[model samples]
Target chain A: MHNIKIVLIQTFHPGNIGAAARAMKNMGLSNLVLVNPVDFPSDEATSRAGQATDVLENATVVSSLEEAVQDCQLVIGTSARDRTITLPALTSQQCGEKLVAEQQSGKVAVIFGRERMGLHNSDLKQCHFQLNIDANPEYPVLNISQAIQIVCYEVFKAGQKQYEPQIEAYPLNDDLNRFYDHLESSLTGSGFIKPSHPGQAIEHLRALFKRARPTSKELQILRGMLSSFDKE
Target chain B: MHNIKIVLIQTFHPGNIGAAARAMKNMGLSNLVLVNPVDFPSDEATSRAGQATDVLENATVVSSLEEAVQDCQLVIGTSARDRTITLPALTSQQCGEKLVAEQQSGKVAVIFGRERMGLHNSDLKQCHFQLNIDANPEYPVLNISQAIQIVCYEVFKAGQKQYEPQIEAYPLNDDLNRFYDHLESSLTGSGFIKPSHPGQAIEHLRALFKRARPTSKELQILRGMLSSFDKE
Candidate 1:
């Protein structure tokens, strides 16, 4: 995966910062730079981060946007509103492709503004591309952490699949079955399947996608897919 | 754009229908077939669709998948899982090419399974191919409407302005036919396909390949598919 930096400018909520850290970690993106975030070292941020405290602790706290994105080749500003400025705009996929392309040669940073008002006009002016997620117009604004999660998730998916060691790569059928057992147990607790027909339902799901037998990359997608549902 | 039919199978959410319609419309795709939508003409759907009500009203609502995709020459079931079955798999891009190619000469359909459990194994068994959209490891799954948007968006992007008009006269259909014949013969020669069924099967293959009639450059790469499979 490319080393992508995320700069959150003037974040007000500590819980959101922690949640953003968790989102970044989930998507395999760890480089986070906070510009004047309120309550950075608070318990709220740490607790919300869950298992991603390392990201917050290692986060580089800066006082200015220029400092945060100084060394970055690609700068992207996330905004839901159309600022009507003539910035070189790109969709998330375009941004993803562009970032992947640049990763071959240099580093990239995606800069996000504050939660409520988003980036000021001056903040967006310094970016190379603007990413506007096509969200519901009525409720176009997304929670800061939710937005981070979505972006990081896409970045992770764009990376090439990982290869396992040769011995582990060719696992026995029993191992496969054991993995499914673990998956079922985890899913059942999450209410993915009914208790009375756990085997039947899981077997059906297993049969639905048995061809690829799922690499770890695919397993992650399944886990993420199920976890995203946990939000509602 | 290939005249491909989109099947929303057993969709329970009307808002998703609206969003799916908007997605299709934005991509310049018109054909939509809904199988057993839980609610139609709902305020939520119309409100959510915003400007895509025409797509929703014109959508064919059928009671069964057999009716929805009956006239199509190729069928694709979208899944986030790698079902245990040994089905031929295609990425969204490959599927987009195939659908567009088929659209030139015949009909095609892309089927999205039910929201909760997705397509039953039996439902997917009917498809010639399964296309998976890579997503986050934990939440690799996408909302029904979001999936529709992404797939259609890719198809639209693939068909965008990539051609430059030449001063040469329009090539005769026979010239195109000769190229198609050469492609078929080369694909067959490379042993990319099993030669058990000769007549209609080959015709199906021909129609399928023709649907996304390749450019001169793409035609050259199609031969690579044959050689790569040979190595595999």
Candidate 2:
């Protein structure tokens, strides 16, 4: 559970951070990372954290979402709106099992975006799977801390059950991002993608590759093929 | 489920009432009976309810705990402490599944005790099952609304109307096979795949892409990438 980092991106409230810490600790999770929080070391957050203040004390703070999940093999972004057709989605239960299983191999991240606005398209692009919590459509919005509680609860439940550790050595997030960058450049140089057109063609390509979730060796092969195209 | 009710007993916080209403609405539960809430129709509660203000507006305010569950056939009490041994205890997951199934026959209720003091022995006698949310023993007590959120989330999941965020249209086998042919020739044209080594390299690449099951649009992107390589 320690390898499963709960990454919060640009959180608006200090209280939510405290509540999130409490939730994570209650679920037997210890890792907590904050990306550009509005306020930290606040009284309000500490007060809400209860006896789980230890989780808040040891939290890692970073400047960007990319920095928070750089070493992770799987980055799961939670989204309220269903926008990214490119990324595969996981239910909360599936997300819990996936996180627990993947954590055995390497660090895995479940990212929570800003309270007011959800994940930016760029941040969404970084995620391997989009975690969607099932709720009533009429009022699907759950408070940020509450959302964290539900996810952590599911994680705790999953942790209690036995799981076979994931055997696949997946490419890390940094490497995956670099590969996407190389892909875009190579496609542009080959005239398969136009600068003016920008995204649809590239987005489709990115989605295809992401949905596939290439293994490290497969990623290497794809990269080598792209490099050869670059030479031409 | 309309037949399912969330009965909060002697709630002290005005904010939690609103939070409970939002949690109930989010989980598709509409019946909320507050047993002698310290504050009713408070601004804090209304604000916390978000789009679920309707649930709060329609909440049943009662004088006593007995009155709240008088009409309900089944009552399940939630407790922070595991004290009741006489009755069957259900994990939160089981509680949700049980509630959903039992609601079909008649009315069912899940009870939450006060913030500071949990359910009394007298209250425990009224409930058929005691609901327990499994958490780290060090910080087992959750925020009132957070507990409600977990229970409601499980109930919503038990309802079995999960959402599919992305409905991908995968490529047909014939189209996928044709794209594999194009990919092999393109890699060979670019000299990334040596023709003399034959099918081994192509075979591995095919297995990777086939496992990915790229959508029809992605297959088109692949084909276009191959076309660009042919030009190179």
Candidate 3:
């Protein structure tokens, strides 16, 4: 069994929770923890889960975030896009990759916020990093369950791709995703991203780096480069 | 003005067709050709296209694949990661980058097979090369519009990135997938796939590479290794 747990904090929809369970099942992940879900074991959720009822039945439901992730060695919070907080962040893939690496050492948990508002700054502070998916700015919001599905899928994929006998080169996609988010965030914070228009400049930046698909190590160097920007 | 004209062949879902149009629009490509789409001027498609209806309204609806690419200098077919035929293939990004490059010299057309069966072998034969997206083998299929979005998005990203003239050495995700696929195929052909299990061997292979996250040059070497098996 994998040493990773997926936690949804204050989830608003029963169907989404169910769908999240289904997504987890499809990815071979069983440890699901829900924090104050709107409904549980509902007919809508069970039916939407299709064959994933087992996941829902076995899921641990808690009332608060602290209780859900207390034992986790690594905790990651999932957000829609940009948040007001200056917290360290990782893309969904990064979060997944990190979880896998951490799994080798200890248990890891990924935290997802509510549908409408997402994770609160207070909630994010509890996490090792915030998770963001690279989505179109015009429509930055993703359905809570869909976001969960993508993140869970990436994590599951990253975990499977972990073959130890052969030392494959480069960071996994999850690690690369993390580095990209850090680069983007650091760049934006450093004012390298000019406001030429509403979203065009950022779009151009994304276009540039996404093509590069920087490795985690490369990303670490980019972060170091950005950190040195403060000295200049 | 990129040389790629994305042709949706007999797309059944109007919303998907519309989404495909939106995807192409976001990627900065305008040339779209539809072949016998189930519904056009559809409220769902138009509504889904959001601001991209102009692409749909201006899209050329052709009678056949031949008519769609007759005047093109290069034709590429898109398929998910599955080997139902024996054909030389490129990963989606490779096809996208090559097509973009080819467009600098001549016209290129990318044909998307029907949603259900994908490009028929005969349809695939019409193309200069077949392109496959690296997705989870169990659910390797992607929605037609999602497929279009990813491919066109990569193409647009590549075009913008190429202009920067940077020495960034990052390998693309697609390149990694091709090498992985080649290894999987060879393993299966060699009877390394576990008996009475449909996906055990391939799943293990996917897990192995997913962790490694091979670089472009490294992937090339791995593919070269697989080619040696073919020669034997």
Best by DockQ: 2
Residue A171 in model 2: shift from native, Å?
A: 1.3
lDDT of 3 by residue, A30-132 (tens): 7889888887769978866756788888899998887787666567778766653334557666776777776775567888888778888767655656676
lDDT of 1 at A146: 53
Please state the CAPRI-style docking class of candidate 2. Answer: medium
Among the candidates, what TM-score does chain A have in each?
0.69, 0.97, 0.68
Q: Write down the lDDT of every candidate, Cα atoms only.
A: 0.67, 0.87, 0.66
* Ranking of all predicted structures according to TM-score, beginning with the best and ending with the worst: 2, 3, 1
Report the C-alpha displacement of residue A142, candidate 3, in angstroms.
5.6
C-alpha lDDT (0 to 100) for residue B102 of candidate 1: 56
TM-score of every candidate relative to the true structure: 0.52, 0.96, 0.54
- Cα lDDT for residue B183, model 3? 66
Per residue, candidate 2 scores C-alpha lDDT tens digits across A95-175 of: 998998888889999999898897899898889999888888877878888889999998888888998867778999999
- Cα-based lDDT at residue A104, candidate 3: 72
Q: Is the docking of candidate 1 incorrect, acceptable, medium or high quality?
A: incorrect
Consecutive 10-residue window with the lowest summed lDDT within model 1 chain A? A223-232
Residue-level lDDT of model 3, residues B1-232, one tens digit each, is 5468999988887867776776776557778999888787689888767567788888998888998899899998887645567567887658768877889888898888887888887787778887876554455555566567657755764575423254325477777666667766655554544346755545544554554444454455446545544443
- How far does residue A127 in candidate 1 sit from its true spot (Å)? 0.7
